[model samples]
Target: MWFFGFSTTNPRNYWIIGAIILVIILTLILKHLAIYLEYSHKHNQEDDESERYKGSSKIDCSKCCSGAIRTYALEELKSATRDFRIRIGVGATSVVYLAELGDGQFGAVKRVMEEKGGSKKMFLDEVSVLLRISHPNLVGLLGFCLDKGEQLLLLEYVPNKSLFDRMHTRHGQSSGTLSWSSRLSIALDIARALDYLHSVADPAVIHRDVKSSNILLVNDNHAKLADFGLCKLGHDIQSAQTPTTIKGSLGYVDTCYLNTGLVSPKSDVYSFGVLLLELITGLKSVQGSTTLAEWTEECRKNKNVEVMVGMLDSKLKGDVNVQQLHVLIDVANLALLENCHGRPDMNYIVDRISSCMEPDIQPELPV
Candidate 1:
C-alpha cells in the first residue's frame, strides 16, 4: 500500500501491528480509568454520608435530662464554632474545633477526613455506630456532615483532659491518686461501652482503636470512651477485619492485631488492660526492657502479678482491699488473654469489674 508518504510494506502487517499497539494503549487507559472511578465513587459516598448529619440538638425535657445532644445544621455548626476558629484538638482521622450555634451555645465540631483506603467504609461505620448509641460514658454525637469528600462529626465537648495526660509517669510513685474507686469506675464505664458494642449492636461494632488517648476524663473523675465507634467489619465474625491504614496507638495495640489486621471488641479490652497496667504500675507502657506483652508474660511466669499490683497509688492504698486489687488484676489479665476468643466477653467484663468496684454492688443488667 502506498500513500503520498513513503511506500508502505504490506497493508496486512501494518494493520496487525497497529491493532496490537492500540489494544495495549486501550488496556492501560482502561486500567487508569477504573482506578479514577473507584476513587470518585468513594469520594461521593463519603460526601453523602457527611451530608446525612445536620442540625443541632435542642433541650429535651424527657430522657435523662443530662442534656441530650440534638443534631445541628452545617451552617449552624459553622457559626457556633466560629467556623472552627478555636482549634481544640486533632487526631489521625479527625480534628476537634470549638464551635457555637445561633442559640449562643458552645460545642465542638469534629472534622473527620476519609482516610486513603476504605475510607467510605470507615466513615459510614462511624456515623452508623455512633449516632444510634448514647451512654453517659460515651461521647455524644451531635451530628455529622459530608461534602465533596470532606466528613465532619459534631460531638459533645468534654473540656477537662484525657486519661493519657494523667499518665502515672507524670508524678513519681505518688502519681497522685486515681483512687481505686475512680479507676474501677472508669473501668466499668469502658467495659459497659465495649459490652454494648460487642453484644448489643446489630452486627456489632468494634472499637478498633483504644488507648489512654482515647479515654476522655471529666471533672468529677469520670471517664468515657472516645475516638471509638469507628471500626471495620466484614462478611462475618470469622473475617471481621477493618481496612488497615494504621489503627490504634503505639504500645497500646494488641500484638495479634498486627498479625491478623483484625480488631474486635476484645482488642479494645487488650488496650484497656494496658491502661490498667499503667494505672497500677505508674509507668508508660512502652518504657521497659520488653514489650508490654513480654513483660506481662514474665510477671505471670514469676507469679509476681502482686508485685506489679503493689505499685498502685498509695493514696487509696489502704482503702481498697487486697481482694479488690487482685480482682482488678484478674480483670486486666483476662483481657490480656492472647487468644481473642478466650478473653472474657465485654458483658462479662462489665459484670466482673462492676462487681469488683462495690463487692457490695451487683450487676444491674442481665448478662
Candidate 2:
C-alpha cells in the first residue's frame, strides 16, 4: 500500500512495529549495562581485597597498583613464619622466610626493606608487576602484607634454593655440582621465563636483573626466575627500550644500559650471556675486576674447543658431553654479541638451548 494505504493501515500493526523497535533498543542498552557492571564489579572486588588487608584507613591501596592480589594481616604472616624465625635467606632489599600458611600451603615470605622512598617504590613495583604475570618458570606472588611500614610479599616456596647455591659451595656444605644436562635444562627454564616476559606478556616486561642468585630451583631442580623489583614494562618486545636509572647486578648489567641509561629485553639477553658464562666456567660473575663476559671474550679469541671446554667446571671435567659444550659456546656467542640487534631474542635462545637438552636423560621421578 502507498502512503494513503499506510495511513489507513491497522493501528494495531503500527503499535506492534513500535513495540518491536523499542524492545531491540532496550536489549542493546541492557547488554551494555551488564558489560559495564561486570567490569566495575571486578575492579571493586580487587579494591575490597586491598581494603581487607590494609587494616586501617591510613593505608591507601590506591597508592599502589594492586590488582587481584590477596592481602594478609601482619599477625597472620608472623604466625605463618613463626615470628619470622625461619630466616632462610637474606638479600640486599629483603629478608626471605619460609612460611607455612593456614591452608597448609608452604610459601616464601619476602620482608622488604622500606628504609627509604626508593625501597618502598621497589616493593610496590614488584607487587604491581608480579600481579600481572603468571608463568611456570617465573616465581609466583601469592599475596602481600602492608602493615606497620613493613611491606611483605608472599611467594611460592621453592625448596631447592638457588642455582648459585647448587653450583657453588655455601655454608661449607658441598651442595654438589649440577650435571651438564642439568645446567642446560636450567638455562632452558630461565630462557623460557624470559621469553614469556619479553614477548608473551601483555605490554611486555624486562627482567632488568638476570643472574644465578635470582634463579630459584623447585623440587625437581627446575629453575624459576625470581626477584622482580627491578623489572620494567615495555609497549612491545621490539620497541621495549625505556630510559631509566641504571639498576641491575654489576657483572650481569648490560654495558649498553649503563652507557645510555636505556633498558630493554636485549639488556636481559646480555645478562643471560654472562649467566651462561658462569654456568660454563663455574666462575663468579666478577672475580675481582674481571667479568665473565670479558673472560669469555678472551677465551673466544683462542677459537679452540678444548680451550673453551677447559673453562667448564673442574667437577664437570669428564662429565660434560662434548656436544653440550659446543651448544653452550654457540648460544653464548649469539647472546653476547656486542650489537644489541645482533643478539638473538629469548625465543631463539630457548629454541637453541632446548636442542642442546634433547639428548639429555631426564632424571626419573619417584612414585
Candidate 3:
C-alpha cells in the first residue's frame, strides 16, 4: 500500500501542502481586501460630492464645481412649477411641467411617478448619469428634488419641443414642416451628441433610448438628446454589453437587444438608424404592424435608388438634395445591419452626415 509520491503519503508532506493552500487563500483574501478598499474610497468620494448638494437649494457655480447640481425643497419646486399645473409633456412614468425658477429662468420639471419600483430606480440612475455628463447636444440638468417622497428633475427648457412632433404630427397640427437642410442639420447634431456619449465621455454612455421622441429641438433647430432614464455606462466601448430588462420605445428598440436582453452602444445605433429612416420617409417607425426599417429593407437591399427616392417624405420631395439623400440612406442601411458588430461608430456616422451638408449651406428652420 505504499504511495509512489512521498508527498502523498508522508505526514510532513501533508503539513506542507496545507501551508501552501493556506498561503494561496491568504493571498486571495488580501487581494480582494485591497480591491474592496479601493472601491470604498471611490464610493466615498462620490458620496462626498453628492453631500455637498444634499438639502441645498443653491448651486455653487464656483470655478472648482461649476454647473454643480442643486437640491430643491419640495415647496420650492411646487412654487416654481405653479403647483405642477403647467404640464408640458407626459410619459409612462413621468410628467414634465414648465417652471419658472427662482433665478427667473424657465426650466422643465420632470416629476417621476412613485407607483412603480422601476421608476424610483430610474430616477436615481438618471441623476447619477446626468451628474457626470455634459454636452452641447445633451439636455442640461439644472437641479433635482428628492423631498417628501418625490423624485423630480429640473432640466433646461427646450422650447421647440421634440423632433417627433416636428416630423410626424399631422399637417396643420405640427409646428411646421422641417426643411431638408433642417433635417440634415438635426441628424448631424444628434450624431455629434451620440459621438460625444460614445467616444468622449470618460466611461462611454449608451443612450438606450435613441428615438426621435427623445430628441428635442432647440430654438435654432439643433437636436438635443434627452431622457437618460434608460442610459447605461459602458466601460469598454468595443465589447461591453449589459444584460438589462428590455426598456425602450416599441418601434425604436433594437431587435437584437429585444431578443437577447443584452444591450450595447450598437443598440443605440440601430435606433438612430430607424430615426434616419423616419426622417427620410415621414412615416412613424411603427405604422400599423409594419416597421419603417422593414418597409425600406427591400429597396435598401437592392440598392434601388429610384425606389428610395420615391419613398422620401412628401414635404421634402422637392427640397432634398439627391446626393445628400443617398448619403443618408447608405448610412442608415449600414447602421441597421442585422449584425450589431458591423454597424459604424457614432464618430463615423457624424463624419458621413457632415459630408452631406455643404460647408456654405446654413440649416433653415421651420417657418
Each model's TM-score, in the order given? 0.68, 0.77, 0.78
Off by over 4 Å in 2: 1-69, 116-118, 171-173, 240-242, 359-367
Highest-lDDT candidate: 3
What C-alpha lDDT do the candidate models reach, one value each? Answer: 0.64, 0.76, 0.79
Clashing pairs in 3: none
* Candidate 1 residue-wise lDDT at 103: 43
Which of 2 and 3 is ahead in TM-score? 3
User: Which candidate's TM-score is highest?
Assistant: 3
Candidate 3 Cα outliers beyond 4 Å, as residue runs: 1-66, 102-104, 116-118, 171-174, 240-242, 361-367
Query: On lDDT, who's better, 2 or 3?
Result: 3
Candidate 3's C-alpha lDDT?
0.79
- For candidate 3, write residues 22-101 as lDDT tens digits: 99999999999999889778645643542332232232333113456788888877876767866766676788877764
* Candidate 2 TM-score, true structure as reference: 0.77
Better of 1 and 2 by TM-score: 2
Tens digits of per-residue lDDT for model 1, 52-77: 43446432223212445444456655
